[model samples]
Target: MLAKRALSIVGGLAVIGWPFAVWLVISYAELHILLPILALCFVLRLCTLRGKTGALSRAFKGLAIAGAVLSVASIWMREAQLLLWYPVVVNGVMLALFGSSLFSSMSIVERLARLHEGNLPPAGVRYTRRVTQVWCVFFIINGSVSLFTCLAGNVHWWTLWNGMISYLLMGLLFACEWLIRIRVKRRYE
Candidate 1:
């Protein structure tokens, strides 16, 4: 179980990190190398998801795969506009999953924990829901703004500002989730 959880975390990081790494590397080299690497990572990640049989997981998987495909397609399309749409597509799907789970009768966090392990405390569930809600809101707002900026074709200094702000917000949300999870674990212990 511990190994599975660790693998999931590592896999999630790779799914998120590989594209950014490719982008960073391409910053110093040719753009052509970026697409193939990004596509490979995306495809590899999509191939590795397991126990994602639930509706929410399936939806997330679909959206994530679609977003990755669209991102690569955008490169070929030569449309920076599609880059903005990428976040919107991925984040929108995540928001929908969170929103639906928030209203469900089942404990979403518990379900997620069970997916990783066997059982989790009620406090853990509450903390998970709260943190996931915040993450959903973060993605929705930033994603919408990014999509709008892309549509407007505004490549200004504020664009960098937007990217930085979004990154900071996500980082803070991730930290808060970790903190809440730790607090819940300590309380139970």
Candidate 2:
């Protein structure tokens, strides 16, 4: 359990740090060694995957790894104009999958709740579903806006703003999930 939690923390850090790392590498023209470091981090992350969470985490990590490689290569080859948009595309794809899974999982949860006559209150279930749906929408909107900002060649501050907004929404989503879980537990007790 400790190992799983640690892996989760590390994975979260990797995801959040990746963009800033890329920006640093580009700004400092340190492509040679930083690229290899990024690749090594990706490999380490790949070695940590063990189950369903691992599988999904690995998928995103792989996308990030590939994007890092492509970004470095593009810069090295003087093709920044083309490869600059790679991260945007990768992030968009990841968000789409993440959003879809939230919707699907919520549907399954609701279906299972329906199996019992005196199951969870309808309002509670609806609240859970609605919260998840809002989260899905948040992911989609954050991803879309980030991609647009990246593609538009805006200043670095734009990306920072996108990151801040995404992280804020994610924090709220986590809080909502925790509250829902507490409610569910209370219902059973």
What are the C-alpha RMSDs, in order, of all predicted structures?
Answer: 5.2, 5.3
What's the alpha carbon RMSD for model 2?
Answer: 5.3
lDDT of 1 by residue, 91-156 (tens): 677777777788886445557777886766676667667766776777678778766765665544
Compute the lDDT of residue 98 as modeled in candidate 2. 50
Could you tell me how far off, in angstroms, the CA of residue 6 lies in candidate 2 after the best superposition? 7.1
TM-score (C-alpha, index-matched) for candidate 1: 0.64
For candidate 2, write residues 1-189 as lDDT tens digits.
Answer: 787677666655765666666566556664545655655555455455644463355666666566556755764775444434544665566666555655564443354345553466666677556654665576577667777777677637544744466677778877977787778668766
Cα error, residue 71 of model 2, in Å, equals 5.1
lDDT at position 92, candidate 1: 76
* Residue pairs whose backbone atoms clash in candidate 2: none
Residue 36 miss distance in model 1 (angstroms)? 3.5
